[model samples]
Target: MNGLFGENLKYDLKASLVVFLVALPLCLGIAVASGAPPMAGLIAGIVGGIVAGSISGSHVAVSGPAAGLTVIVLDSISSLGGFQLFLGAVVAAGLIQLILGLVKAGVLGYYFPHSVIKGMLTAIGLILILKQIPHALGYDKDHIGDMAFEQMDQHNTFTEIYYAFIYNSPGAIPIVLIGLLILFLFEKPKIKTHKLFGIIPGPLWAVIAGILINETYRFWIPGWQLGGDHLVSIPELTSLGDITSLLTFPDFSLIADPNFWLVAFTVAIIASIETLLSVEAGDKLDPYKRITPASRELVAQGTGNMLSGFIGGLPLTVVIVRTTANVSSGARTKMSAIFHGFLLLILVLAIPGLLNKIPLSCLAAVLFLVGYKLANPAIFIKEYKKGFDQFLPFILTVIAILLTDLLVGIGIGMVVGLFFVIKTNFHRSLVVTELNGNYLVKLQKDVSFLNKAPLMKQLSTIPPGSNVVLNAVKARFIDHDIKELLDDFIETAPNKDIEIILEGFSNHVRQKA
Candidate 1:
């Protein structure tokens, strides 16, 4: 017990506080964005920090409700007919993820194309900005977390922005503008390095500033006061009984629904991919250079999601944003994660009224910044510079998700990425170049049956009376079809008056031929 709490306690304690502040607004905002009760996000944050932190092999990785999953969660709840039914999907997903971890299937994350994943994130960013614009302008007809282009209120993404201008609230404008200023100020490097500012996150300050400004308007300028739907509303817990009553359980009866299983499988796969990617990024940032066992991480995330779902929380996954903050704050162990969870639990249980005073516009502004970061123009330029092989899938993913839904968009991106891989493979494996009267045919990679046609075509194009060099030194494996093609070419070389120079296929070719 002493050793557990003695060594590195100071550093971990300070880091935990910083991470908790950073996570607080994000948890609430993500819940509001996901159309779940604000407390649900808090529950996931606590479970991720305490349960996942305890079980995961990672020393500093932090888990929570992610912005990436908000779209799926919102869509699933509506399609499943109720939040209770959606919780069942979360539970099932946790079970599937647990089974995957036990069977050592964590390596599946590597199969996903990098371009597709980036595109998915970029799409989510765009959705966040579009959906949050209404809330930021005080047009609260739709749920704060709605991300679909079409709204339940009969307005589309762009039309909603037009409506926002027509019905803009006088009070929300100042609150959001001031909130953004605070957040942006806190993000500045000089202020971020300040001891007080560094310890307290920008979003928290934005929330505080929003609360004070609204209260001030309420007293001084009643005409510009914001209230009701414009403010965050959380179910306050006053006693132990209230706490139990506030916690909800999933509907196990939904297990027979095919849609439930589909949602489950989708959540499991995406959560696992996000978890593996976040943990890998954490390992890269670790000063200790400690490697997190990917399989163990999946198990930890699965356990957290199960508990979170049972208690009516959003699905859980390791979040890179919080994890980066944890590491940068000098966290040395998982104890910091556990401590941050306790802090979140304390905040919701002890002072939900304080959380309720925060304006939705403040949260919207925070999300606006997040969206800009994810869909930054610089990201597009970077991908474009990487060539069309990467940019095509990336842009297609963003377009597909914006046009359709998350799952279908990802599917489209994956198919496009695979097509590029096959097309590039056929064109890039063998190279035929001519210099003066000599021809050099180089094997850039392994020669399989896929390369037979290209190899034959290149060999056929060589002019008569030219010297040809067949270079297979770079190829590790040569298929029988390729070898046959080479032998046939050599047999006909004499007829074409071409001299063949064999560079790397002594064993594969016949001496007589």
Candidate 2:
């Protein structure tokens, strides 16, 4: 047991470090965009890693407050009168998530249509491309926002494209070019020949190269400044006193507001959906093919959110960005996630100066690649071949998410998927046959409330003065509602001059009906 757990621990630590590096800049950037202190993002990241990761069943999944939630968090904070009040909603949301997990609501994740997942991936990729363009060009007017295409219209992404020629920063071009070069080199087969070079990831190499290029440009030409605004700046917090002062508490007084409950419920639902989706993606990327325990993940997320809220941090959930980075970085266990959180804590305390030097554009390039992979055309083609029932809902899900938001899009897709499933079962069960002088009707598998509508329509349309037989030989289960419907059909059959025969009507079937 020790050996097995030990191996996992080692793997997780390695994975966590990689995830920490990837998550650090993102946490700050997202918090900045959400109109909150940068430290709020870091605090959430720490809680998500240590608190959530410790309890989560997922080996590779990483949790944090995501950019996707920024708008909601910001709005809640504004309306609630302060960030502390918003924290109250987050705490409430965490409790709701915990209750949902206990009720085994995670099963909902399994019912999501494949097409919808594909569509979501595509939409997210498109959004990443649009949002990252501004960052790549050194315009930090807004944070990388939602997965919607139209949302981009409201931000600098639209404006920066037109202004690029007129207001382009000279230093940005070199930094972006160097970052791209690093990415190219990492992808090149020739570079793999070198042992030291092959061990490093493309994103890490790009960050290093970006730093070097910025320093080199500054040294050669003192007037050409590229270091300050273009890069990630670690917030100045000198002592333990400073850190203590930063901590915020939830405003329990806000509990009186009905809007608080509404916001809390919305956050819980959306955060759970996002977490479940990320778990699915993380499992896909796991080399061991391990399936994450969904209920435990919700519990972990809940705990993390609770802690984050207590510390005046943002709401937390399983984020795809850091999880993907963890997988790609060869993370093998949950320790990587925990260690990543620890690393975040240690780095913030010890080496804020070093972190402040890294350029944001370099990070943007890394995210750009991630977005591209998520929305690749190959995924669409792959899902399309799964059949119309699969692809249609997936396409609808993608469009819905892009046009509306994640939860609404997924809800629409789920409804469509449920309809298809019910229709398929109904069509399969519907068998009409002439047995001797009687017309025989047979059901396949189980018949439930979903099959009632179609069954009623078929029964009402049956030819008058015809004999009918209802067979249940193939049905393993039937709902009471369906049995009642059958009873109604029997009572009315004689009035229409139709003879009725019921087969395999056991005591159990009668009770069930």
Candidate 3:
């Protein structure tokens, strides 16, 4: 056990660092989007990294405030009358999550269809692509949390694109172009083969290059600017004393408001779903094929959120973006997760000023690449080869997610997949056999209520004055509803002048003659 855990610890450190780098700007951006102090996001990241990572059973999963929850936090704060009150709701949500974890409610995660999950990743990818456009072009009017195109306007994603192009700030163009070029060059397969180049990820390189270009341009041009508004900025903290003062307590007074409960419930449900999905996906990506403990993950998340709420932070979950980064970075253990959290804490305490210099456009470039990889065309080709049963639902899920929001799209795709499953099972069982002018009805094994329609149709077609034999030798368990339907059919068969004989029974019972 020591050797196994030791190996994992080494891998976790490397993976955690990669996740930390990816998470830094995201944490700040999401916090800014929530209309709370920028430090709130950082606090959540720190807590999620340290508190959550330490306890979570998910070895490769990384926890932090998610962009999907920004809108929820914003609404909660507004309705609750203040950010502190919203923190109270978050604490309540955390308690709920803890209860859920203790009760082993995480099993509900299994019911989510695979197609829907794929679709969610694809939809989130598409949203990242859309949301990043303005940042890529250097437009910083909205925070990173603005996901829906409709929220920008009344129309769809295309309309938002048209407006951004017509009204975007030109200064952002140069920085965006440079960032994109850096991303493109780093992704070249030839570069990845080189020993030196392979050591650093494309996102890290793009960010470094972006920082250099911005600093150089500022030095030479004097009055020229690269649109500082399009960059991430850390909240100004002059001293350790100031940082201490920034922490806010949850306002228990808000517990009296019904809206607080509503928001807490919403946060708990969504966070659980997102965390479970991330756990499943992260486990699939693990090289060791290790299964993560889902209920334990909830407890970890709950603990982190509770701490975050008490200390002026947003709710968090096991985010897919950071979890994927952890896996790709060769992370093997929970130690890496814990180390990353410590890193966040150290960075925030030591260098808030330095972190503020990173450009939002550069981060957008990283997310763009991440999004593309998740919804790559290669995945479609791979799924297609698996046959229509797999690809059809997957494609529908992708399309639905892109057209609508995550949950709605997944729900629609699941319904479609379930329909196909039922239809196929029913069609495969309706076979006919003729023996001396009598019909032999052979039902498939494991027939259930889903097969009732086809079974009834077959029973109705039995010829008058012909003997009908019901076969059950090959059958396993039949649903009680189906058994009752067959019994009803036996009673009604004599009225149709058919002599029904039951096979595989002690007595050869016939329909009343």
Candidate 4:
């Protein structure tokens, strides 16, 4: 039991610090993308770690304001007329998620196809690579949030990449190049073998280097020194009282609005699904192979979302990036997750001014590597060899995401995958073989309405005046269409002098006997 709370104290502390560093920029960036105050993202991180981490059944899954929910939050805040009203909707969403957990909706997550998930991850990775080009080149015009393909400032994604070189920050380029070099160098297999280098997480080193370099630039190269727009920005706080003032309470006055309920419902369903998927992914990443309790995870997330809303924060999900960072940094227990929340709380309250000095390009370098890892071409080729059934949906998903957003792209891939599923089932619905002066028809495990066409086609080819054996020994489910087809065949077969022997049709065989 003690082991779970950072039982390996050294490992947990190092991992917690790395996750905190990775999350700081991301939390603020996602909030900015959501059209909420930067502080809202931090608040959600605080609750996600302390509150959600405490109740969640997952040992590794980290909760925080996720980029996936940015569209929903942005739209909700805009349509609701104010941030406070949207907070009310978030609270309602939490309650609805609680009800969903109670009803055991967690199993629904399993319904998502594995290929579709791979496609989703690959698409996100590609998007990250494409979008981070500007930040890497030190063009921070749209640095705070780069989730959408079409920028709110009227610039599209590709143009921003093209403009990055033309308007690149001289100081930022060196910082990014050096930062990326250090990051890549540290990840070498040999460096990982060294005890000293192994203990210092790569992202932490990159951040420290970025901060010192930026400070040095300000000292010597003041003209090209990066400022707030090109750096991480945590609002400086004078005291605990100042932090207290920033907390916005949720306004429950609009809770009665039917329209509000619809928004809440949307949030709850999407959040739950996203949380469940993250939990599954986290459990897979766990070195110990521990299973996460999905329903309980929903409850924990619900509690965190409600607390975040109460404090005027963006909605939280079981965020995959932070969880992956936590895992990669060798987190041993839930304590790392809880400690991350504590760190966010202290960092925001204690040293917001100092944290802001870290260059945004350094963070972009980190995400760039993360994106490359997720969308590795090796993975694409691996799935490609699995044949068209897997590769088609996977590539289509990546292409669709390039054209559209994440959720829409996943939906498109799933729809395509479903067509393949039906097509395969239709082809396998029935089988026919010929024996000594007789015919045999074998029914598969599931014979549904979709199988009707193929089944009839196979049955129609049976030779006239030939004795037939209909086999259903292993058929678990026979839909009405299949049964009616069999009944009509039995009635009309006499016209062709076809004698049929039925197997595994208990009632009909008994009646004839």
Best by TM-score: 4
lDDT of 2: 0.76
* 1-513 per-residue lDDT for model 2 (tens digits): 125777666556655655776788778877876778888999999999889989999888989878668778878888888888888999999999999898888877765665666666666665666666766777655554333333434633355555554665666667767777776676577774457875666677777877776678777865544666677777777776787877888888979789999889988988998989878767876778898989888888888888898888888889877887787666777888889899998888788887788777777777777677677788889888888888888888777766666667777877888778877877786677664556777877887887788788778777778878788878888888888988778777767888777787563244222
User: In candidate 3, which residue pairs get closer than 3 Å at backbone N, Cα or C atoms, i.e. clash?
Assistant: 12-336
**How would you encode candidate 3's per-residue C-alpha lDDT over 1-513 as one tens digit per residue?**
136776666556656766776788778778877888878888898899889989998778889988778777888888889999889988989998999999999888777667667656666677778877877776666676555444533556666666678767555566667767766786687874557876666666777777776777677764435656766776676777887787998999968778889988999888888888778777766777888889988998888888999999999998877777777667777777788889888876787676667777777777777677677778878878877887788888877766765556767788888877777876765456887878887665567777777777777777788888887665665667777777887888777777877765322223333
Q: Say which prediction, candidate 3 or candidate 4, comes out ahead on lDDT.
A: 4
- Global local distance difference test of model 4: 0.83
RMSD of 2: 4.1
Q: With candidate 2 superimposed using the best TM-score fit, by how many Å does residue 356's alpha carbon deviate from the native?
A: 2.1
Root mean square deviation (Cα) for candidate 3: 3.4
Give the per-residue Cα lDDT of candidate 3 at 333.
77
lDDT of 4 by residue, 17-46 (tens): 878987898889889878899999999998
| Clashing pairs for predicted structure model 1, backbone only | 33-145
Question: Which one wins by lDDT: 1 or 3?
Answer: 1
Model 1 misplaced regions, further than 4 Å: 1-39, 57-62, 66-89, 111-126, 195-199, 250-266, 277-292, 319-340, 398-424, 506-512
| Predictions in order: lDDT | 0.82, 0.76, 0.76, 0.83
lDDT of 1 by residue, 105-189 (tens): 8776557688887887677668778877878888876656455566556768889889998998888888889878987897788
Estimate the TM-score for candidate 2.
0.84
Colliding pairs, model 4? none
